[model samples]
Target: MMSGLRRGPLASRFSPSRQAAMKQSVKLIVGNWKMNGLSAALAQAESIREAVGAAGQGHRVVLCPPATLIDRMRTALAGSGVAVGGQDCHEKPVGAFTGSVSAEMLADAGATVVILGHSERRAAFGETDAGVAAKVEAAIAAGLEPIVCVGETLEQREAGDAIAVVSAQVEASLPTGLSERDFAVAYEPVWAIGTGLTPTLEQIAEVHAAIRAAMVKRLGESARTAPILYGGSVKPENAADILATPEVGGALVGGASLKAEDFMPIVKAAA
Candidate 1:
């Protein structure tokens, strides 16, 4: 049974508009649990399930736990209407990559989505756009939707090159022939994640719209239908306003996603 909560003004006001957006609404709230989580973390999946159940359908909710916990989270979310995803996956299906998990392995573990080219992976692990593209291809081949992350640093934003930088990243990171079902794009503004700084609603809209336009140019009609989510300093307080913005489908929550109490309202906001 789904949990139920009264619809607040935020939820009610968007009904008609949201219904309209729903047709093009690719809003997704993905929780990147990152390197945190063990068996105990699985409990949060229930909390997330309850939250989504209470919110009652307005957004798509996904949980990308560590590989170790993907199967557990998958089982926990079964029939719960929430999607389970993987934090990352290797480009190769089989190899001498000792510590890496392949995209096929993730799909076998029951993951339906995978996050690729996250800023951390790019910066810390030195992953290139070409590498990300390979992983994106592998993920699609394995029947998983890759939420390819693209972003620019504060320096780039300050230099007025945010769009140009992100545009290049999107174009290079995405594999050719991407369809709405095969992937989603996340614009996480590298400097914003967990920094408590959100782009103004206008800035958010501009970047998202730019991403959509890029998609349309590359993927045609499917690009318009592809959900482009916003990331970076996204919290429950701001989730509603951001998600309500034009071209803003959903969010890629970072630090806030660690707690059910903190994350649930953001889910509600999306709904």
Candidate 2:
């Protein structure tokens, strides 16, 4: 945490209207816990709570821990401005999917947002664009905003298909129904996740601009206001520069988010 970072006031009320109007803000730092965390990890959360206790109106903070920790973290961060979220959820609200958790259950457990179409899910679990679209619909149906993600692999970038790949994914992964809802998109270049590498500022701007153009085509003129966040390798060291880019409204942070000391500076940078 950046010792100079200041916490915001207690969590603010979230209404559907307010949700729709969130496009007016800038920073929206979200932490994806992936499959890590035990109950003890709540301490880091508490530290984060203290650090950003009265964060500015332009900044928003969210933490997406594994399923088991969602409810617990929500309760812990009750008054803190930090919001709790889920990493993934099945498209259906109710089913015999066994271990699969649906967006409804996540919402019930206090997840205000759900991340779908992550590169890990797409590559490791074979989550196709169609499937991601379904989950986005599910998230809305369950009353949870979805942080839909899209990105390109190193090979695709090397092959000169980075923009095309991301454009196609945005076209396929986002459905027309999203035009009626509030959501955010993340561009997490696959090669950068935990790899300690990041695209140049120009490279980041290019992809973000491409994504904005794609959404504009999908949602019409209003899409220009959508928050296209940069993910992968987002840490305190470079968060300021990355967030300063033209279309980088915020970030979808990975490993650096595990601790408040590291995450706060990034959060502060956004502020």
Model number with the top lDDT: 2
TM-score of each predicted structure versus truth: 0.90, 0.91
Taking every candidate in turn, the Cα RMSD to the unseen true structure, in Å, is: 6.0, 5.7
- Error (Å) of candidate 1 at residue 160 is 0.9
Q: Candidate 1: deviation at residue 182, Å?
A: 3.2
Model 1 spans > 4 angstroms off: 1-23
Model 2: lowest-lDDT 10 consecutive positions: 2-11
lDDT of 1 by residue, 94-177 (tens): 999999999999999988889999999999999999999999989888888889999999999999999998888888888785
Please list the residue runs of candidate 2 whose C-alpha ends up more than 4 Å from where it truly belongs after superposition.
Answer: 1-24
